[model samples]
Target: MIDALSPLLILLAVALPLALALAAALPAFRARALDLLPFAPLPSLAAALLATEGARVGVPELLFGVRLELRGEGRLFLGFASFLWCLAGLYARSEMRGTQRPTLFAVSWCLALAGNLGVFLAGDVVTFYTAFACLTFAAYPAIVSSGTEAAYRAGRVYMVFSVAGETALLAALMLAASGAVSLSIGGVSASIASLPQRDVVHLLLLVGFGIKAGLVPLHLWLPLAHPAAPPAASAVLSGAMVKAGLFGLMRFMPGDGALGDAWPLLLLALGLAGCFYGIAMGLTQTKPKTILAYSTVSQMSLMVALLSAGLGEGAAGAAFGALSLYALHHGLAKGALFMGAGLAPLARPGARIGFLALLALPALSVAGLPLTGGALAKLAGKMPFSGAAETLVTLSAAGTTLVMLRFLAAAGSQAGSGSERLPAARLAPMIAATLAAVALPWWLFPALSGQDLGYVLRPDNLWSAAWPVALAAAGFLVWRRAGFPAPAVPPGDILVPLTAALERLRKPWAAIHYPPFPKRRSAQLRARGMKVLLASERGLLSWSLAGPLVLAVVLFAALYRP
Candidate 1:
């Protein structure tokens, strides 16, 4: 029956890449497997599409009684994550061909792929943590794949934050698990409130997950890491891997659990701040990838705002539906846009129009243009927002619209210059991913959220989505006519000052290991210190000196009262 095969399908999706990763250890297999890198995610794609409902599977011997399950948001995440991975793999195949050390890239890709898939399917705290750790560490090589100074610097920044986030996550997990009677995610979430230090646990979880979600202050690494990685790796990092953090929030804090009202409101405030902050910073960037990275930060903030509002209203059903829909659409759309960044410069003169069209579809969708996936995602997500919050949500759309327009302008200029044409290997994946971004949401909205297509197509609903984008377009035209200069902020604006501070501390840190004392003074100081220490030791060893000291200490202790 279909039910029995679903678990098997899910297992194969994970096992395929893992098996390939093991085989990559052999020299002959490594060379041959390099060619098959593009196909590594095919089984996962099939599993996502064919597996109907949720299923649970256990692998006791492999992972300490590890349990994996597919259901609800997990299913949606697996579907979209797998879809993006497949598209990225295709893009990588064309981009990485003829490059040295293909096996290195391929193995890293496989490990990351397996870990990304595993995060979505993991059913218990231990399983989820294991998958999360794997994803974090495995993706490092991908970020540093360029082997440039920038790439190495980005890798260090990424590892520093990743390790910090994991420390917080481990602490939170241990706290949540301590009160849990059962080890499954559901059991831990339900039992978290009973712990003596539940508030501390909640804060730690927020910090851990928020760092991965690219919440500000903790978000500097994202822009740095994304731009440093290859296009394929960037696509997954932004589109899929970041969602793992959001997934943790949903899993660990389902139905608002014990977070109270304060946490959700705080998340909302942070989200709104990031929404505008990201756009302001992004406008100054020259690199298309860096611009896209900031756009992601802004978009994720909107999702956090949505989740926070849902928690505030206590409408778990509608909030989760909207969350899943938005995440799914954003992941696909962002993946397509990143892939397009790589292909944009390669558009031939003859196919230039077609290529620009491909880029525009997802770029506009990211702005929530009418009839696009972004519109549906925003619509579904904003159902719980009303009054001023709702108005701000609409205005945030306009701000995103402005950012996307700027991205297109930059990408267009890049397309204007290159002579190389996009070959079929590269072109096919771009087209496929873009089409999916545009059309899949139309199919998925009704299925995932159970809203009639007519509801989304209603005159009022269409107008709600249209006005923000329309206003943004008019504003953009006026701004263009006025000819305001784009501000020049460094790629990681906050990182520059932080790096300088670290540089100032470098000498002090080094001095601890290798002191700067002159040799003559050092010898004299050592001899003098040794002589004083020996004299004091000889005096202390004497009963006459020791007894008086002991008697004085006791008298002091007895008379020490104020």
Candidate 2:
């Protein structure tokens, strides 16, 4: 009887945000909206905790055949995401409290969270895609919070990629619905064995989810988008939001099939490439948040590889559940770390130790270092690897260590940022989140996967975790000793060349927009002056007159020549 109530709770969770968004116009709630946005996820957080450990959350039909459902894995993801939303809410209160229009941001945050958690709870692909699409674009305000040129650019790029990726997912969903399991992710996953268009569907789903997961080439937006937001927002964006992409892949794509083998291999290749690529670029970053963003790219790739391995072995159950936990820990720890980075400038001498301690949790967790949930997350991933995947995992661990160590070094060197006096609302949530990151995995492991907690604390495991950090630290020392400077290349290396090429293309397009089109700065001024003319009376008259004049001239010349 209680089990049946799970879905109702999930629906109510989503309703909280939807209701708040609708009620924003209420004069009484307008000012209170900011206070309500974070707690909007409370229902979801409760559902996540209640339903995560194989809770048989029943599906309730919505529309003709669609189901708004919450399964175990779904509940698990919802739990983490909702928790992040709650934490971010507190952070926003502290950080963005003084902003001009808090309601707008509050509304965006609640709506985005609703959509984010909804995607996971969605039983069918359409519902999932709808929720996902909501999150993908609705998050724009958070990305563009400061409204700087850089912020706008980051938000724009994020919006573009998000649209492209969602379109791909939607198309794939339609195809899956056209003949297969009627669009339910569970249905598709079940019937994927008999599906004729399996390979095509797999690849499309991979690409669609890959874009959000920050897979190479498609990942151009992470470093830009993550650091562009406020500290708490950045925490959730990096930690929880990106996981939606990966979660979509895990749910939508067939985890194991002869035809799907190629897709997993493709995922493996991309994950490995992303792992190394993130580390390479991260080493050059001067900003702690930017470096952490790059580290997310690398670390997330490692988690992707874990899912690929599960798919390779046909352990969909483990694959889905483990990735949920992985996302859970990474989100909390990463959020904490980023939030902690925001505090570097204002921490007192007495508080500095506490702050570094806060920052260290995620850094170690991300590196898969022992005594952290991140280490457990990696240990669980080993279930699917034996030979070559082992080597790949090791390299990934090494890469994560390098990137995180670099991030710490960079963050420590500054000891100061633009902001001062960390707010309690922001500080409290991160601390709570970090504590949760430490304990949740251990608590949930027994019920979710039945893995012994003892394994997480073993000496050999600690040594295994330590070696990667030791080696990376040694390398950092050598590089520093040799006077090797961190690369002076700007954050988002590809943005420069991409921007230059875009300017070149815009020239031709602008030419088409206006006669003689726009060429440069001076031409731009003339176009602004004549924009009215381009669409004005004089412009239409001139075109009409020119057409007849040319026609008359042509007719006269032909007759005279004859």
Candidate 3:
């Protein structure tokens, strides 16, 4: 009975959200769709809690025989991701009330939720790519939901990077699939390491997933997107969606460390660079959300470094549990911070102190304060590091702390500037997310790390976590005394100069006009055909058409597979 039920749960996890999204796309249910948003992720949450590890369901009729499974790390990823999505959905319903294009936002939310959950449960390469594509395309509407110029610009940037990443991933997948014995993700991952073009495959995978994970230089989309999106959307964008790239890396990269020394060393170098670069850039930003976005870049880079260390030592299998724990801790805590930022402006003057204190809990946890989940996560990640690497990892906590302090100050300054009282609907989700961030890691730490609470509480371990936060606090005080002398670096630091250069070139190019060519029958025919193709492409790309098409495909796979 248990075995039979597990597969059903897995099927429902992906199906439920797709079904809701389909309903949301209809005219009759469009207005009520947002009301049902909170319920869409429930099936995924249930699957995460009850599905047995190693249990899988296969749908052979689907593209290249789709498979869904729950493994140890996948289960943990699903659980935390589902939890974040559910809460974020509720927050969205509350925050986006009376906002423009409610139906579009609702459909996008459900489709993106389905895709995010599906990525965790996908057991085959095709299914994984399908889900990833669904997520990448569906999330664009949410980024531009505000309908502002900045929002549209951010959406465009997000799409350009997402398309590039997906294209790279598709090429890599095609090469890997050609050499594998089966289409299973595990099989393909194992075979890729032995393929003749292994080096090329590895580079493509890293560059593809690295974009989504906000690795340096390629991470310009994140800081822009987060600030432009609604609070709930930003929460999931930063908290859960970015994890898709990390998940992709973990799933596709060989666990046996067949990536060779160059790949691991290069990854390590990039990770270390991003860790500090995010901090340096984050310090110059004024917006709380942008600061948090850069913080994600740092934290995610640190995780990549941890993964690289494991690969270098041929112990990636051992590193998986630690990476999952760190990801979970960061996801929940960061979600809380983003939600808190949304709620801050609504706080009454009398409640300001309580709000700040609430915000600080997750911030400190993120900074690795003693006994918090972040500390345990930090400790687990440090297991594979030593000497200079360990010290640098520890010092990063100080940088994270300084950034968190900046975020707290920015959040506090916005209090009482909006409505006189905070709405319970909005307040409840942030508080719940905050408490979960603090509590869930403790519950899962022993299972993920194989170490008891006492080990985390040891005197040496406590000291390791405390000193960096202390140093950061002291440094923050000193910096505050000096009135924050750092010059303001514009958000999307590299993008600013690059955009200016392009604009300069565009003006000169536009000034030099060419004479019109003589019209011919063949040229007219070709032009007409091109216009027809472009029109069809635009229609297919619109949410009204694309959302249902994706849902229809997944629904058919779920119901028709023998």
> By lDDT, who's the top model here?
3
List runs of model 3 lying over 4 Å from the truth: 518-524, 527-562
Cα deviation of 222 in candidate 1 (Å)?
0.9
Model 1 earns a TM-score of 0.89
lDDT of 2 by residue, 1-562 (tens): 5577676677777778888877765788887777776678888888776743444333446544445666657777777888888887888877777787677787788878888888877777666777888888878998898888989989988888887787667656666776764666777666655668766667768778888988876788899998898887898888888898888877766655544567678777888788888888888888999999888888788778767766755576776667677778888888888888777777765566666766777787778777777777777766566788776676677778878877777767656443555567777888888888877887776555546877766787677777876787688789878998776657677877998999998988787754564469778888787887667656657674664455446545744854
Q: Which stretches of candidate 2 lie over 4 Å from their true place?
A: 51-66, 191-196, 416-421, 447-450, 457-459, 505-562
Instruction: State the lDDT of candidate 1 residue by residue for 240-323, as single tens digits.
Output: 999988888888874653567887888888888887888888888888899999998888888888878667545776788888
Clash totals in order: 0, 1, 0
- Backbone clash tally (model 3): 0
TM-score of each: 0.89, 0.85, 0.92
Can you list the residue pairs that collide in candidate 1?
none
Q: Where's the lowest-lDDT run of ten residues in candidate 2?
A: 51-60
lDDT of 3 by residue, 183-270 (tens): 9898999889779998888888987899989988789999999999999999998899999999998888776557768887887788
Q: Which candidate is the best by TM-score?
A: 3
Whole-model lDDT, model 3: 0.88
What residue runs in model 1 are displaced by over 4 Å at the alpha carbon? 507-562
